[model samples]
Target: MRYVFFNHQGRAVLGVRTADGVKVLGEETLESLLERGVDLVTYGANAQGPSVEIGEQDYLPLMRKPGKIICVGLNYADHTKESPYAQPDYPTLFPRFNSSLTAHNKPLVRPKVSDTLDYEGEMAVILKSGGRHIPKDQALEHVAGYALFNEGSVRDYQFKSPQWTVGKNFDDTGAFGPDLVTADELPAGGKGLLLETRVNGKIVQSANTQDMLFDVATVISTLSEAVTLQAGDVIVSGTPAGVGFGMNPKVYLKPGDVVEVSIEGIGKLVNPVIDEA
Candidate 1:
């Protein structure tokens, strides 16, 4: 079932999209629902007031807040080729602080500090529960679901400094949602779908998840070995090539540009670019 976080009567709540419209999930966002141990069924009510419309409600980040946000870099062979260094044998991981998470359809601000803000369309896996030293075979079992991920980046900061934190963990930069879908509802793991990115309706990046250097299962398993995976933590797999920095002329985002990231069977997430005011 498709689920989204929407604002209702001055508060954020989870809603399920149905033939009747959005059925209010509960008094709070999905993160709250899980925290209170509320039955998922309780969120569904029978035709309350006029059913609220999707996109009409103010959106909160799918989880609102997560204990940790882990990300992988150059997990795609194509992205590695674009980098200025040699590819590593293992995943190059980084921590994207909670401050980076943003809701879908929101304006992604290009901070005055960085001039080369770029977009990296990616697929992310959300952990449903906590597990440590999780085996590779059981990694997929722990996933709650998937979401469309737009890894908005500051290329100048990323390449200028050795550590990626300054470039990656910017405020309201990481975009995930429309909704968090259950893993059972999607195709098995990593071999099923095409993920693409478009800027202002023009395709800038296109590739299949099957091309990922380290598939979902491998990423989860590897990361779990180092850190305990929690219920709301997100693991952004990686993005394909065709990033602005990789282009011949090096295209970057400007005010009023709309960026779209889509995954088959998951959903699409679009964000507009705005100057820091």
Candidate 2:
């Protein structure tokens, strides 16, 4: 079932799409939905309060408190080519703390520290349960779902030094969601899925997930070997080319610019750029 976290009244609430409208699950989001009960049908009756239509308002990030937001870098060949970085034989990983996550339709703060902001369209995987050293064959069992993301980056902060932590963890740099499609529900694992980034309605970058150098399964299994991925952990499967930094004359985001990241079956995540408060 497609699940989304939206503002109900003034608070974030989890919702399950229904034939009638949306079944307002509760104030708690998807994480709580899994802990309370997977069968939303059981609570559908008590959830009878008028449901808010998602498109009518802004959405919060898919998960409010994912334990970790692990990111894979240069998984796409074109991305490596654009930046002219070495192709990785294995996934190049980094940590994007949970505090950096913002929801779909939210305003992303382009901090004053950097003017060279770039957008990386990507697919993010949310972990369903805990497991360390998980085999490739069984990795799918650990995935809870998938969401689209614009892995916003500050090039100066990221490339000024080898370590990417500082540039990658800027507040609200990672914006994703609309909903998380359960792993089993997505089409052909790691196959080409269209991904695109548009700035103010103009297409900037577009590519297919099939262009990925390292597939989804490989990323999950590789990471699992070292870390016990728990429920609510999110893994961003890198992004495609067409980034601002890759353009002829770097085109970074400025205030009032709108960025949209789209993945074939997962849906689109749109966020507007805003100056830091």
Best by lDDT, which number? 2
| lDDT assessment of candidate 1 | 0.80
Cα RMSD, each candidate: 2.3, 2.3
Model 1: residues >4 Å from true position, as ranges? 33-50
lDDT of 2 by residue, 1-277 (tens): 6678887767777877767777677786666655443543344435665655776455888888877889999888888989858887988999998788888889788998889878888998877675788888887766777888788998889997888888888898889797787665676453677888899999888888888887777888888889987777888999888899898888899999999998888888899999998
The estimated TM-scores of all candidates read 0.92, 0.92
- What TM-score should be assigned to candidate 1? 0.92
Q: Ten residues in a row with the worst lDDT in model 1? A: 38-47
The deviation in Å at residue 49 for candidate 1 is: 9.7
Candidates' C-alpha lDDT? 0.80, 0.81
Supply candidate 2's per-residue lDDT for 48: 62
